[model samples]
Target: MTWTFEEMDRMFHPRVVAVVGDKKDRDYMWLRSVSTLKGKVYSVQVNPEEAANIVAMGFPNYSSLLDIPEPVDYVIVAVPRHVAPRVLEDAIRKGVNGVMFFTAGFAETGEPEGIRLQQVLTDMARKARMKIVGPNCMGLFNPRWGLRHSPEQYYDDGGPVGFISQSGTHATFFSLVGYQHGVKISKSASMGNGIILHADDYLDYLGQDPQTQVIAMYLEGVPNARRLFHLMQEIGQRKPIVVWKGGQTSEGARAVQSHTASLAASTALWQAAVRQANALWADSFDETLDLVKALCFLKEPVGPRLGLVAMTGGQSVVITDAFAKAGLQVPLLTPRSYQELATFYSTIGGSYRNPMDMTPTSRNLDMVRRVLDILARDDNIDAICYEFNMGFSAREGMVERLVDLLGEFREAYPRPFLCVLSAVHREAEAVGVRQALAQRGVPAYPSFQRAGNAFRKVWDYYRERRERGATRPAPAPAGPVRPG
Candidate 1:
């Protein structure tokens, strides 16, 4: 339908939303999902029982989209597949800006009827110049406006990340899991069986979205590979785009067709395309969030040289190996940095080389602060990683103090500083500490491997950005991206 950016924006930030066929049978799922939306919500149900129930829920009930008094900005169609055409006709007649077809049984079903129905709706929407999100997908999630695809999704705590996924489950999971890990989203779309609107359309819109600073994508496949790749190259130059392509394997590709009717590309071809476009690639959900967290929280790391701080000698060796294996350098600190460390750096059960083993001395906050200061000033190091066992830190009553110290270092230093909080039989305590660190603008991972991997992705992104002369000014230091 060739929707304008403004039109898409309004659809995302709708003033009025309508849900069709939200009945007690499904527990009024679609209606409840949009309950937190900061706009008028109407239920379109022809059934008298469902209408009365929707009224009891407080949202006004209407027989059809045309019966609604207000102009519907967005419509969620949850009617049966056979009834979808009628709803779409009504929606088009009502002049709705967008309709997200949450109803399944479309082309993904692989039946002729299903495919024909999909084409029918596609033609209708295009003829009427209507914007449709998905006939088999989860639609838009705008946290800022509390427009959500699921009731469980967070609201009113928007961040700088914009996510696009083909699978509805992946979209919902990304928002749910990403939020707990400090990767709150600005806007996200689950574009299932993207018939009328392609993934490139969402990418183009998000690329220009002022609220979005980093874009994350979960793609089963792209219908127009060339256009998608071009958008990646153009948009990625401005904002980092992290892509996690599903259907990389033969089995996954077979599943992708049935799941979204998508044509999965060869893994080699997809990887090469992503690298050529200078877009980051992630292998799984965790990696996607990890990369996003790093991109959102960390400053632009100028080099691969990483300075490591571990509480124990074994940890130092392990983390060093982790980072090095992740394609990051654990080079020796400059002579000047070593000379400064020699001043009060005791050699008792600790070493102050690259991965400064702060075993016994780590208990002393002053010594930890000094070590961080030394690393921050060292030219050989572009990023810093500090590892601590959360269980021990809490027992020593140093969690709060360490978080504050790290917060200070984060603010004072331009280098990207991260913390790896090992659970060590205290997983709950580790989560609290990680949250605290996140609140103070420090990216904390559960393990050394995660910390190193996330940092390496950020490093690769910045390095590519620099090489392309597309580097933007460093983001201002801030707490977690979530709004207070």
Candidate 2:
């Protein structure tokens, strides 16, 4: 059953959503998850006890989807496997836009009954041309519309990333953890089993979504490799798509079969195909979010040459090595840059070479600004990375000033400016500082490795973009900007 983009759009942004089979025994989990939805919500339960409890929780209860007074745009099915077909039938009869089968005893279980039940549901939905998200998955999350699969997801705020994951756990946690690091979601889906709607379906939908600037995927496998790769090649030319393939190893491949009933492809082939399609590849959850964050905040394709700044001498060496290991260059500054630095640089406790180390003089905002200014003007420097101790910055009452300075440089200079906050014992302080910088449209990371690696991915993405002749500067960082 091929669904049109407009039909899928309605499913994502529903005006009225219904939760089927939410019972008191499970604490009405599905009901609670969607209770915060901005649109009207109703509960469909045959059990009188559960229906009464749902009503007590302040939601209308219906014995069947047909019993609902108004048209239902979306339905969340949480009934047992045997009852899933009945719910889908009712949903099709009601002519709803879509249904998410939260019930999990589908083909992934590898049981004869599970397989048969899944086929039955699939056939019925396909025959009716009704879109089903998953037979063994968590559903969708649209923060802008207050639609969510977990109660913990943030609403009333949205960003440029649209994430698609085969694992419900990854989908839920990605949004939760991403919020901590300033990577918010415009929409996300956890499509387990994907019996009716496949990963490529969601990818194509997100590609056309104007709200999403960067699309990230956590996939074990896709049903149609050719279609997926073809779509990636086309969509990636416009918006960046970062893919993190799961089940890469032999053991993981076997696990993927039971997890989502997906047929894992060869790792080598997957990686090569991803690059050929002009999409970025990530190894882990952290790398995916880091790449997304970098893509979200950095606006242009940067050169591999980076100008490094560190609070201490030792850090300068460590930062350089980290970036160098990540395939980035930390070459010496141009002759004119070094000459300009020598005029005011204090050689007493610092060296003004590539990674300028301000031993005890970093506290002077004027000198710090001057050094950054010189790097910004240096033709050889394509980007700048500054490292500081978050604990000291907060204690010295310099967090706001430093953020303002970086923000100013970010705006005044076209080169990418990044910040690395040393949060060894100061993780709590780093969080606040990161948020402050993010509010000002500056990206900050907790470690040199992550800062370097993420920036490299961003650089690679834009460099490829430029190589393909799509040379327009990336759209201004897609999230909120601090008010002047």
Candidate 3:
């Protein structure tokens, strides 16, 4: 079936749901799945005795789908693979719209019989024209609808990010990480095996999803390469996409086959696709979250030139190298601006060329503020990175001063300001300061490389967006390949 934003809305936000399988002890579905659903939910257990206990605990249980009085919009199949086909048959007879398989032992098992059973389920689903999420997946997790994987997990009422991953853990990973780091999320889904619904389908859905402005994905492989590339190009023009494509190496590719029973596209082709779509590619999971923070926290930077302030002169060298390698510029200040900066201090030991050093002289909070204020006004500087290391041993109230200064800079300046914590972020005082800054929507990095990389991604996105003009042009169709 064709995919669209409205179709996604109707399918994911279903009115009625059925959990078809053997009931687990303590009613796991009632606590984790059914309790979270914001719609009418009923479970179909084959054993009448277990069904009685399930209904007694909390959720309404049924002996079979045929006995239920209301129509089922979605089904979560948790039975064994051998029993799944019959459940699908029952669902089709009952006119179910979608199914998410919480059961494994299908294609991922690397057995011929499992593959055949998966094919049977796929054929039945095709004839019925129903969307299937996974034969080994956790399905959809949406905060607006209160859909989640774990009962203890917290869902942000309405976040700004829509995430889809091949692994269920990655979906849960983002939610846990986002909750602690202040990264708001709208949707997190694990489309396991991706047999029926592909990753590109979610891209189309998220591209027009009004609640989501940024899309993040963790992909192992795509069945239709051309479709994925075109869809990414279409979505990239409207919203930014941060993708972490797995199986880029020979070893990783072998692992991919066993993991999902899908072919791993060559790294060269995958990178080309990412470049063609003008989407951001991440090397590590931390970097993936880094891109999310950059997109969510900082505004678009005007240029790539960065102004660095440090706690020590030695740290300046490290910060400068990191910035340069990350595709950012550390430009030399004009002689006039240099001389104006020298007015704040003596020219003997103080250096004012660029990355205005505040470590040499004794720093009062006001003087440091003026120095940053001066650098922020310069046309040569598009973004500012300040290094702060604090001690709470009555060290002249360093933590408070730095926190206050950061707040003021955030209020006064329009450019993106970064806090470089170096190795000091591990300190107890620094951790407190970091959280404070993050709460104010200010980004604080533990090291120079991370800080530089985050800013570079932010710059590249805005620059590309600017060059492409205000609107992204739709791509022309290529031969016989067209978006389904």
Candidate 4:
């Protein structure tokens, strides 16, 4: 069934929810899930006396939606698949709008009985005009509400980065890494066994969500390719959507089918889908996560005008080649700008050009400042990429000083700035330097190649979008494909 923004908003942002499943003795576990839900938690299981412990722990648990005196908006079903159908039917009968099915043994199990059972539930919900999230899903996490939907043990209402992953492990990994990188998430959902709800359903909902500024998707396959593309096209024009399509090979496709009962559409079809939608496609998990983090934090940069600021001449040369390999252009600094930078480095001694190398003498704050000030004023450049090294010198607060200088430069003239710090010294020192750079709106990568690759992804996406006009209609809906 298709969904609009208004429905999801009212359903997710509910005042009270009923968690229907085996009641956990762990106080407030259901309440904790409800607490994380961005609304009041109410338990609707078999037992009432045990549910009070959840309310005492700050989450209201109820026995049933019908039994509860107050109106219930959402239901979380964590029972077995066989029983899930009954629970769902009960919720629908009670007039609940949304249901998060955390049960397994659906279509993914390759059992006809399970598939038919799921179909029965889906048919019932559609007939009743109610929205169902997943039959074999991990559930939803709203960081803002501290609603931790998964059993993986993550809590917090994250920032504006909305993540939708087909795999629960990937979702958990995303949460862990995002927290580590200081990238807060607004909403995260691990949608398993998409019986009725598809990825596009979530994307469309987020399109209208004020809290979801960027969309990051991890998909094994899409059920409604046309709808997914349309949603992606709509979302991409406004906010960046980064996608990592798994199941590239035949074996992998089978695995994805087993994992989520997805169609595992061909790689060629996915490539066309992404290109037509004007969405950014990442090859690996690292690339996918990096693109998402970068897009979420850094400003969208136009064109490939990349300026490299290097702490050493040798590293500068290395980065210049890396940039070329990554399809990045190093526009030569305008002669006027070069001379201005020259004047700043005349005492320290270094040539001025793109990949602007400040020699050993110019390694101090004043030299870095002069070069940054000159580049900041130039309109030819669109992004600034810099490299730093952590060694004996940085322990003397060299990294801190540079971070402050860069921060000041960003404040004075805002643009997409990146830092690639060489981890030649201790990991702690490298982390300190990376964190410092990140604190100023600059994304820090460990290697020049990584920085270059990320810049390439950004630049390639920009160019592709420009060439294709980025508003093409989505491909037509596709029927199920046979296994090869």
Clashing pairs in 1: none
Model 3 C-alpha lDDT per residue in residues 261-372, reported as the tens digit of each score: 7788888888888977888888778888888777766756889999888655666788899999999999987666677776775545456667655665435677678778
Per TM-score, what order, best first?
2, 1, 3, 4
Stretches of candidate 3 exceeding 4 Å from the true structure: 22-30, 46-57, 335-353, 356-368, 388-408, 421-439, 470-484
TM-score of each: 0.95, 0.96, 0.86, 0.84
**What Cα-based lDDT does every candidate model obtain?**
0.87, 0.86, 0.75, 0.72
Clashes of each: 0, 0, 0, 13
**Per-residue lDDT of model 4, residues 1-484, tens digit only:** 7777788777657777778763554433445555555456666656566655555565545556677676778787877677877787778778887888877888898999988988888888888888877777766767555566644444543466788888877876777666544455667778887666678888888777877777788999887888889888877887778889989999999999888888888998898888777788888878876776576545556767788877667888998899778887888877789677655465344556777776664457776777777887787888888676665244466767777887677656667777777777477666555545655656677678877888778767766766766642221111111110
By TM-score, is 2 or 3 better? 2
User: What TM value does model 3 have?
Assistant: 0.86
Look at candidate 3 and tell me the lDDT of residue 87: 86
TM-score of 1: 0.95
Candidate 3 Cα deviation (angstroms), residue 134: 1.0
Candidate 1 lDDT over residue span 1-484, tens digit each: 3557898899899999999998897888888889988999999989998899999999999888998998999999998898999999998998999999999998999999999999999999989988989989999999889899888887876878899999999999988877666667889999899988889999989988988888999999887889999999998888888999999999999999999999998999999999988889999998998888888778778889999999889999999999998999998999999999898998899999889999878888899999999999998888899986665575466888988999889989997888888877887666567767777778888778888888888788778778888857336234444422
Candidate 4: TM-score? 0.84
